[model samples]
Target: MKKLIQFYLFIIFSIPCFSQSFSFEWTKQLSSTYFAEYIWEIATDNDGNIYGATDGGGIQTFLDTTFDVATSASSTVLFKINDAGERKWLRHITNSENGSIAVDSNKKVYSGGWFIGSSSLPPYTLTAGAGFGNSSYYTTLDSLGNFTSATKVFSGNSFLNSIAPVICNEAGDVAYIDNREFPSGFTYIQYHTLTKKNSGGTSWTKAFTTTDVVPLYIDPANNLYIKGAYTSAITVGGTTLTNSGGQDIYVAKLDGAGIYKWVKKIGGNHDEWLQSAATDADGNLYISGYFNSDSIDLDGIKLYAELTENNSFVAKINAAGNYEWAINLDSNAYHFAMNLLVDEDGNKVLITGRYTEEMTLGTDILTVTPDQNIYVARLDLSGNILSGMQITFPLSATIYDRKLISPESMLICGTFSGSVAFGDSTYTSAGGDDGFITKINFCELPATYYADIDNDGYGTPDTFTTACNMPIGYTNNSSDCDDSNNAINPLALESCNTIDDNCDGNIDEGLIIATITPASATSFCKGESGILNANTGVGFSYQWKKNGVNISGATSSSYTATKTGNYSVLITIPGSCNDISDETSVTVYNKPNATITNIDATNDLCFDTSIKLKTGNGVGFTFQWYKGATALAGATSNIYFATTSGNYKVKTTNSFGCFKMSTPYTIIKTCKLGESDSPNLQVLIIVLVALKCQQPIQLLKIVNFGNQSL
Candidate 1:
């Protein structure tokens, strides 16, 4: 099944973007009526076929026959043409000849504006029955120029007023703005109303009372963006837009539910008004407007513009309303921007406007052949002009709408008088003021050649990869005087001590060696910071390096050396004729100034006592306590405890990772005896036993040891 899903693209008449090459393809003049006629807008589909809304006789009648507007007073026409300027089909729908047009992804065309008398065309039939009348009409046509649907918006009771720029995001999801004057003073104050709807029958509408409104756009998210001109301070959606001066431009954004997001006012004190506004795929808004003020304040950055006449201003505002960039296209006499577009990536920007007299773009000044001319410029998103041209035709012409059909082609349409010039060929007008379709073809970036300077790189506007990728000594890098020398490359470091360090083909351009006092001592304590001073000289820049590596932010005349290493200062005058100072050797002594102090007051060991030795603590210093020739286990702090005394000392390492040991101190000890060693009683007992034995021997002769008892 063919899906009915569709998307309506904001047709931006795109020119050759980054590629500075362009040429006119073909031009075809269109006409259908003897009366004054014009094509208001143009668009293109995926196939590159040209389509637009016009009020001329270029289309066929309702009966599928060629239109003869010779008898009809005025007619509204929608047209489609091939790349070769050949018309595929034309449809005449109404008599009232003013409206805007848009296209969708399926190549379905939509044309809307104004019409009088019940349009006899299908779907545009009178809402008030068959009768001569006026109304606003919106019609859709397929790629084959077949009518899909037509809608008569309003008729009978009220004449169609003014239409704002219409935004149709996709099929069945469209948001449009229009204004009707309310009953007020002698002046007609426009009260603009916005109507939003989707295919699912969701609908929302909002009304803002303002001076006048122009471009209205809808982003992919269905958020509505509006542009209008105001005379005084007016508030809309609870946000106030104050007039900067005579007239100021007002822009506001609202969500799908009609909720206000942000409102911004632009312009300062002179008369100004924006013609149109568009959003890139990322929702960054690009606005084109004309101003007469000497300077325009974009958000806060003030841009001084030459207002020789009315100058055109193109601005880029991010989604949050932050001003990115803006510039003034000085148009000599009068100018008005018809359209503005930014590619999806927000890199390439196309601006189309009508200017009289002459306009200077970058270095190219273009003077129109006669009266006014149509101009298109390709610029960066920042409004920097890269390349542009004067797309012109004799008499007067201006492109109303445009679309980039391909990378190298554009579809443009507008009304022209007399004849339209397409490069070498010119096509005369079919009748009165006829509509026109033009094709502009572009080519890829032209090949560029650059000389490899210093045999290292080539000279091109781009970086090394873009233009110098080809095999050779050629490079895309630029401005090399010595291509044969490898030291002449742009990346080569220029030094004041040597000649031509930078490969820019200039010698000693900015070389100025600075003279200063070197440190008296190359060695210092770990906590000490070494000072390096350079002498003052004219036309010199200084870069200090440590061990051949550039020190970040070390560009001053004097440098404090924190770490010990080989230090050198590269000094060069204006041309980078660098004169490097002799490299100085600075040694950092990190050994712990580990001071081991015998904090113990007592040198002699007493009963069951321990002593602790002390050492002063400092940065990057860790100490280990020792006793004579043996290291104390688990004694790594500045203080150590000695359970049993011996020769004691401490070892410490400083910031430079150096270690030192302290002299040893000794502790003396003396032990006393106890009372358990007595033996007097045991000897006395032995003597008694010996005596008894002797007595027994004697008593054996005298009463059996009676003497022993005594």
Candidate 2:
């Protein structure tokens, strides 16, 4: 009987694998004759295209096309496939090891690895400087799998390049970190050489000291993170961190200009290797690996690994190099290679690795039958394991790469032998260990819902939870601005309340209250003007109105009323609210008529004679008399007397508080007593003036010498 992998086995031996919360959709097996080894790395572009880098020997069959490796050594093979598992094209790099692959935002593909001896990559051949060590090689290809640039090789004597881990930014700036081995004193030292090249062909390099380093991710901000294992103390960015016994794991971050941001270390008294890492959209880092130590310290929280067997662990770190949480699986088997990936939305973390014997994942115990030892787990951002499952291969299997695809699916590529079962479908290898790519999906995880307290078909955005079904008092909509009121939602009508009824960040929108200053009628003379002011607001447009019509060029908050009319203003907020102000009646009245006339019409009035001046209209008018420019005392009447005046006028005021001035009436001193004809006559004139003549005295003919009547 064939050996079986038992995941929480009960009494039955033919039971299905530990019930998984996920199911396999499809699996594609790449058959080969001479054993297509590891599927090193896998990447995807925005166009849903999947690219894989692998190593194989001799002839390999990809879809319907067979490709030759030419040499007997393991050569690098890069292939492209669509989202629907359709192979597009493949390239063979002879005599190269398993390489790394990355797809930039521009859909440009990058592939690199270390090659021994003379490796041929199409028209470009890279020859090693020496016949012993390895030299790094890198190349680029367009989205359609066509070569866009010449293959570049890096080789020198001081340092040796091993595996090339490459990445690129949106601006087509390419950067890679290659493992460099060199001799320091009598001992051989290993580190990483980080080379950055921009589109302008400007390039620079930086060195990091470690035992081995792997470049895992480059974020959208061009910040890169590298994970490695170091045995001794290493200084980065002026901070020195000493290893805590055995081989410790270190993660470091560098900006686009190759400046070290920070470096962190995690380890225990025994050995720990960080094998896989991933970054979220927020630049938070997630790493997974195996440790043979009894306990590993992650920033202050410790996880026990049990010295008897190797265990797998996962941890999360913030962008500022702060440890959030860490967790480990209780397993007695040796976890070798592992791959990790965070979902595109950064909600979930997926970890895939190979393990032997038995492993304890959370509350479930999974026991593998002999060689069937593949584990896949899903975890939340808080380091809580959601689900765990195992993929059983009768012979051998190693998952090297895992990616998250569209429509909530996981695409994993690896090498498996014998017959491997993926849910209901099983794939058998053609000869040796064949390369495989499988798409898996979660069954039905709980989804988050918000609370709808007012039953308004909308829910509060802040209060939410995850559940398998819609919880009572909860809904899928999260657009309710006020959950306590049913009328305050995204669909609610705006009113005069000081609140954002439509959840659009505006208060009382579309229900404008137009108001005017004074709020009363303005009274003025016909030729005079009165100012009418309306309410002012930011982003508000105004149009003044005379009665109910829009006044031309009256687009201001204040309007000038020149003529008698009902004045108003249209206040508007463009695309939002508008209103017309209450009518402000403006009464423009004509001035009261005041015409002065001389009653005693004479050619010239004598000095001692008086004249009466009357106004044209005296009813309902108050009059004032003026001599030249001086007002006569006690002249508040409809008529005035002119005794001896050069010019006289009357001012008439009506009940409407409007006053008018009549034209001036002139009077001349035509006749006068002889100044000094006789002293006695002058004395008589003086005596008459002293009497303050109450009545006008008719002047007789001038009598020279004593009072002679004329």
lDDT, model 2, position 7: 15
How well is each residue in 1-710 modelled by candidate 1, as lDDT tens digits? 01111112244665444333455556666654455456666666666677776665433232124557536546667777766656688777655566567666667666665556556565446443233334565666777877787776654443234343455665535666655543346654556666776545787877766555543676777777776677788886677777677877777787777788887777776877676677787788887777777676777866555554477888888888787888776644556665677765547887777777677776666676654466677778767887656655445665555566765566666667777666557766655666666676655453344655445653534334222113243454456645567765566776654466575666555445445466556677666778887766776578888998899999988888868898888886654456677787778776565565656777556643766667888877877878787788888899876667588888887765567788776766544222234322111111123354434453322121223221
RMSD of 2: 15.8
Global Cα RMSD, each model: 22.1, 15.8
Tens digit per residue, CA lDDT, model 2, 1-710: 01111111000011112333454556677777775556767787778788888777767776667877753677878888887777898887777775777787788888888776788776677887763466788888888777666554667663456546676656677777666566778876776777777655777777776455666566667677777677888776676778899988888888877788888888888788776666788889888877888888988988875444578888899989899998886545566436676765548877767777666666666667665566767677888876666655435556666676654455777788888876566777777778877766543464677999999889998898664335557898798888999988998888765689998888876677788884334887767778888888778899888879989999988887878888888888756567888898888878998887667767266643777777766457788889899999998877777777488888888877788888888877745554665456552243244656688778745543555653
The candidate that wins on lDDT is: 2
Off by over 4 Å in 2: 1-38, 71-74, 116-118, 156-161, 168-174, 180-191, 198-203, 306-308, 329-337, 343-380, 384-395, 416-433, 441-710
Candidate 2: pairs in clash? 4-369, 5-369
- Model 1: runs farther than 4 Å from truth? 1-23, 57-65, 128-133, 156-164, 170-172, 181-191, 329-337, 354-375, 378-390, 442-710
Candidate of highest TM-score: 1
Each model's lDDT comes to 0.63, 0.72
